[model samples]
Target chain A: MSKDAFSNHPITPEELPQVNSQSFTPLSNTYIKVNLMCRLVFWLMVVSALLIIYWQPWITLHKLLELYLPQVQLAAGGFGLLSSVYGILADKNKGYAIREHDFSYRSGVIFQSVVSQPILRIQHVELKHGPIDRHFGLASLEIFSAGGAMHTFAIPGLPEEKAREIRSYVLTHSDIAAND
Target chain B: MTSYQNQWLKLSPVAIVYFAVQFIKTIGNNLFYLLPAIFVGYNQFSENALIIISGLGALLVFVAISALLKFYFYQYRLSEGRVQIHSGVFQKTHIDLPFERIQNVRFEQPIFYRPTNHVCMLLDTAGSNKLEAKIIALPKNIAESLKQEILAYKTENTHEANDQEPQTNEEQLLNSRSMRDLVIHGLASNRIWIVLGALAPFFNSLSEKFVKGIESFGVDVDALMASSQYAFWQYVLFFFSIAFVVIALMALISILGSVITFYDFKLTRSDDRYIRRNGLFTRHEVVMKLSRLQMIALQQNWLDRALQRVNLKFEQLNANLERQSAGTSGGKIIVPSVTLEEAHNLATETWPNNQLSSINYNPVSKRLAIRNTLIAFWLFVPLAAVLTYFEKTELATASIAAFILSTAFIILSWKRRGYAIDDNFIYLRKGLIGVSYRCFPIHKVQQTTFSQSWFMRRFQLCSVKFVLASGGQTLPFINARIGEELIDSCLYQVEALKKSWM
Candidate 1:
């Protein structure tokens, strides 16, 4: 076997490029508004359903509703409000960094995580946007690796053009087999 | 290409039995959904034996015809170092697997094929976890030659062909398990618990039936218990004896299963490939290439630890996230009941620089124990309090006991969780009652993740996870600085080594 010259040499930690040294670029603020709007629509629909159920007479659930309907509504409203607040805080903390040979995404409000995927290992990259996201000019970039159905991580709420640029950059830098 | 290369090949006539078996397995797998229907129609069918008999006969006939049709439609061809298969009666599907993409070529000899001297060949590919192609009921000679042809093709197409010449292909016996060793491994492994778990839902009914059977034999168990013939201490002794007998019986069953599954187990190495051969009724042979191996896991449960033995598993690029049948998992070869020294020796033999025994493992932060205990208290204390308020003293006591046991387990596991790293390899040790030591080359990591909860961030501690082709391994609650340093070093090694993780 042909031995490489640097095979036996160990690279010290000081010589490596530290991930924490780089600053992360925050996501688009419009995603927070979109998330709030989605949450509002969902709670409104839930309230309407509850009202319809209460007005209906065919179902015998009226007896149970008469005792617990108010409490259930209050709980639902409280949960909705709490989740929206958490979502906004989480969105504010979400950020990503485009390193030379890898991409890093940092997220979570209470449980913070910084995930880095090597460009050489990425199988493919996808850009997706829901109706609400499109209306607010935002897109999400989904990165996939081999051996699993779920994406490695999806960096959400990027400007549409920035998402496209990142996708193309990943495609160009990664191996050709990634396109397949 | 060989002379048979471009011509369509049909399976032997005996493959009809194989297809019938496959059909039955498929039906059995989906039978859960049909259970309610069967119950609903039970009375109607039970009153008329003729209808039931006719229905079963028709079903058998249908199964026979479908198996025959499936065997007739299945055809495969070999051309230009690739295999193409055409199968399915109604769907008419096609599969193409190139020689290079094939990961392992395995052979199985079912009991039914013994009389005919035929073996079943399964081709495992890297593109998917499922078998790429299966040619059932092939003559032994033909299967051997086919395997040789594929291996030769793979060797020729490999990038490092010059170094991997035929002259260096010398087979060496690495390890073999005797009958005693196999029995010990069976006893030590946790498969007994798995078996009991599968039968747990029926335990109450099973015990009731046992009591009734004794009563039918004219043994008045309840009357004897009510009589003063047995003292309290004697009753306790009787209970202990029965428990011992049950445990012994279960252990015996587990041993029989282990012996049948891993009888005459042998591991052999030839150049860069490791071959494992085992099993009793259905002899199995699996081949693993060294280049594709991702990690090695040395697992020692409580019993295995007491016996000073460990079960070593060589993991590969297994896209199968779920457990599968023994032979077809494709990406792992398990060496059961090896000594601690032997396990380390084998690991070093594979990776050369993996000094597993000499490495110092740095334990994770103690804050892990506190956090886990807090989470457990948050989950269990409220339930225990409610039970106490409802005057369910027994249940409340049980809840508190469970909480204590879980808290102790968390603390013990936190003390054991550690990571050791060197220039070439990274090792992780973890478990509560048992321990699993996993190690891999630093360059094999495909991704690195650093996570910290609000509580952990307050203490400047974080968790780091290394994602590999096999799976992900996490080192929870470590210093934030060390986590960053580890990630930076791993990323550097991955980028600098320029090695293919596949």
Candidate 2:
């Protein structure tokens, strides 16, 4: 296989293109809230577990150390900070790669992975948003592939109009197959 | 007992009673494990016992909490066009499954559940490959009532089977689609599958007993060898004798199982639908639209081919849906045990008016069959050797070798003998045990590709692959030109088909 097969978009479009304005309906904010709420719950679990394990409840003199936390607490804080730094650094390097045949994307820190789906394999497309995303006109694009109900591709932080245009690109195109 | 009325007035008090009995049995089984712990924890006899008692207490507490949470949180309702189920003790799942998405619904009420009128429902959903989501338990009456509600929504009042006739045009649309063949097909299946099933447990028990019996004779090999010497060829003879018996028993068990399960196997064709219903203990009904079939397959092992029996399988276009929650409909293969002529007739039925296969078949070259035979012989040599070694007997080894050689010879012969296709269907006869002939409408193909390995490429041979909506099935290794022509014809046919088959 050629290296080009694996490479992200080597060519950058100069000056960001305007969003496609036709047939766009932003996703309901409820979807976004539900997704974010799930993410928040996961975060809370990790946070609470760390607090219970590391916090010395009986040590009043260690209150100064409370600012620093016990051993496990420090490790968790270190982890959070490490992830935040990596997230922003990775986000800076991240750029959308679009192709006539397929698309590629990567995100997250330790769990970072790249996903690519052929247009022919996509079964459906959906634009999703939450209340916070609605205010910013930001939406997430999800493309279903094959028989799977979940998204094959999820492009986050895109304007609602862009998501709709992507949906049309998938829908109106003959090369792509649609779910019945 | 609270009275519940069925819209269909078809109530099997048996379904609900079976479910209740099973539920009670499960509670009883759990109690056997839980009673001692409960007594110890409640009595709190000693200091050392307190820890163990507390552990048991904790388990019981957790169970109670989970059950409480479940009762409080779980809710399911059937609406006009969909069934909405919301369930979670802590993390909730709101499932909105439309009635149209339901593919197959299985009602299972275990033997133990015979006392109470309760039945568990397993719904196969389209595109979602998960085990069935549970619909709430209701009286047999209510269950039947719910089924009628959905039927009423989907069917028009015209061809009413159940009491609630369709009032709207949408239900009429569903009614127009016939289902009379479904019941008919279920009745024709073979009864041999049940007989086979009954023998399975018997063989398993026999094997276990034999193992124990052998162990009871003691572990020292010297004594066994000495005793064996008094007998004929000793270890070799004894081992082969036992191995042969075991293999025969296992094979018999499997054959019987297949016979019993498919004892009443039936397939009925009505208009554009092929309905197959077969099962013994648990009957199954599957209805497939003719147009949705991706391929009609005919297979015959050496034994079947020689006997002039062919097993026909029609593969439908579907997904690897999760076992429980699958589209009510999926790609299915109808397996009918029939004579070779019947299979040919069924293949024609697969494509009612089709004449020739899309690809022209050139007989497999003599060299090709020789090549295939050599590959088979090579693969089987090591396997035969290993089995002999495991059996540790000369007679067994000889018998196995003879079987292997004969199988390879059959493969060698079958490959040389092939058929040609003209324009619409593909007929393939390959392997000794894996004989297969596949037929599909050339026009229904969505995409086609020809692939070649280096050796094949050098030989001007390539494999043509046709990808339909279901999945890709390939006819490998043919002339590159022929492969290309077949691909082009398929593509052209697909293009000419203006209907939205997507």
Best by lDDT: 1
What digit string (tens of lDDT, one per residue) describes model 1 on residues A14-87?
A: 87888888899988877778887798789878876877776777877756667898778778777888887888
Looking at model 1 chain A, report the run of 10 residues with the lowest lDDT sum.
Answer: A1-10
- After best superposition, candidate 1 residue B258: deviation in angstroms? 0.7
TM-score of each: 0.91, 0.52
Candidate 1 on B333-356: residue-level lDDT in tens? Answer: 888899988888888888888877
Q: Assess candidate 2 and give its TM-score to the true structure.
A: 0.52
Clashing pairs in 1: none
> Which ten contiguous residues of candidate 1 chain B have the minimum total lDDT?
B320-329
Q: What are the per-residue Cα lDDT tens digits for candidate 2 across B88-177?
A: 667988787777666544444333333565555555655646634665454555655555455344343334565652232221111110
Interface RMSD of each: 2.2, 12.9
What is every candidate's C-alpha DockQ against the true complex, given to 2 decimals?
Answer: 0.58, 0.03
Candidate 1, superposed: residue stretches over 4 Å from native? A1-11, A54-61, A135-137, A174-180, B27-62, B127-131, B152-155, B158-164, B167-169, B326-328, B380-396
Report the error of model 2 at residue B146, Å. 6.8
Error of 1 at B297 (Å): 0.6
